[model samples]
Target: MSAPPLSLRWRRRDEPLPAVAVAASGAVVTQLGADALMRVTAGAHLRACVGREQSWLVVLGDEADLPWADGAVYLGWDGGLLVPTLAQPWPCADLLREPLRRLTKQQTGLIALLPELVLAGPLPREPLDPARLAPS
Candidate 1:
């Protein structure tokens, strides 16, 4: 089978989502993690991405975009992070990477999911020119 198409979305907190269009390169992800989200946004040169709570701004597209057909693994929000239930499904192992499993409850669950996005392969790392990113 082929992989589902993925999408990426970002916005500053407590503000309206700008109508900015991204390149067709398909940078995208979920509770959407904070660190991973900030990293990408920072790379995109969104000002102040790392300065505030960014989890909500980090929408890795619809939750449905996740490989739920493989099956859903129950996770919980503990302390400030997402904790998986003991009944972990082996098939969906890709959903939980090493960094996520090691996160302390004190941390945001969003931070754990960043490595997976990075490991998905190299993204367009060249700095984006601000002029090309003007909102429609």
Candidate 2:
């Protein structure tokens, strides 16, 4: 059978989210709903997203457009970077490379059964990977 679709939670657009603020301070986690809700917006719009923005939404298209974001790190069930790595250069992971792009890179469980990560922070110092640990 095919894998289940990934679960994504997002905040309402009318109200701005505190993602950037938290990023500026630090990134943390939790399992419970009330626990993780802070990752996204408090209230405005929330739902399961087949796709979510890692950062903010510029809304280039309809609401159907993967919760379009101006910024945020999106990860599919398999953990591929959602938005576009077309021209962005990641510090360690050459997003252009096949292996890096295909694998579930840094999409870890922090909040939202899965959370869209957005930040204008510094690129990682080295490749943040744990490939050897995967079962082949």
Candidate 3:
């Protein structure tokens, strides 16, 4: 079967830009145990799985492309960062049932899912720049 078409959405043109630290890397590490996120510089594979109200991040050496499909929504992207759009009302239980996966390079990493509560913090802050985030 064919895969669903990937759709992307950018932040409003008037919104402020995101921080450089969070928007400068493609490969990011999810410190699930620590309740924090870290950006990595090496890795060939990217995997994101959801369960209960939490999302899991996995990296491997196998090369792959960004896993995108229907129903998936991306928040923003800068010259270096990409954010995932999660469902509403804090923890998105819906994503836990249907997870997403992608094979991407370190320069093209993945930001699987971000809960609403997390969004209130300082992680993702702007829409992605399609021109800069697109594969070159």
Candidate 4:
């Protein structure tokens, strides 16, 4: 099968390694080209190539934070193009995993990340306490 067409965000290399790390663990990404991302700190964004059937994400390490990149172009496992920055948790994440995995195995796509703030949505109308935002 043919890989998905390549599209890069502006200044992908200029971005910090932390952003890349976020991408690795945020979603199902696969790296394309040579494994030249070793210089990137652990859990970096890891490279990938867009495949025909799937958009693969290279697993670098654990997700340091939210994986959504402001201008990043993500192809979900189901052929959905998502700018993860706008992704909502819950069904959105679960829905995306399917397409992401399927596409990765086929297209082998690559992702360059730009970190951003992510607000986890609460269940129903029960607002979460700010104190619980992080472990003290």
Which of the predicted structures, 2 or 4, would earn the higher TM-score when compared with the native?
Answer: 4
Off by over 4 Å in 2: 1-27, 31-42, 47-88, 91-97, 105-136
TM-score to native of every candidate shown: 0.19, 0.20, 0.22, 0.21
57-120: candidate 3 lDDT, tens digit per residue = 2221112223322333333333223343222222232332222322232222333333321221
Task: Give the alpha-carbon lDDT of every model.
Answer: 0.27, 0.25, 0.27, 0.30
Greater TM-score among 3 and 4 belongs to 3
| Residue lDDT tens for model 4, 1-136 | 9777433333223222232222222223322211223323333433232222323222222234223433333322212322333333333444544444454442333322223421111111222122222122
lDDT per residue for candidate 1 within 58-120, as digits (tens), equals 222212221121122323233222323332222234544443444323222343122123112
Error of 3 at 1 (Å): 54
The list of candidate 4 runs beyond 4 A from truth reads: 1-38, 41-60, 64-70, 73-86, 89-136
Worst 10 residues of 3 by lDDT: 32-41
RMSD after Cα superposition, model 2: 16.7
State, as a TM-score between 0 and 1, how close model 3 is to the true structure.
Answer: 0.22
Give the clashing residue pairs of candidate 1, or none: 29-60, 33-110
Ranking by lDDT: 4, 3, 1, 2
Task: Point to the candidate with the largest TM-score.
Answer: 3
Predicted model with the maximum lDDT:
4
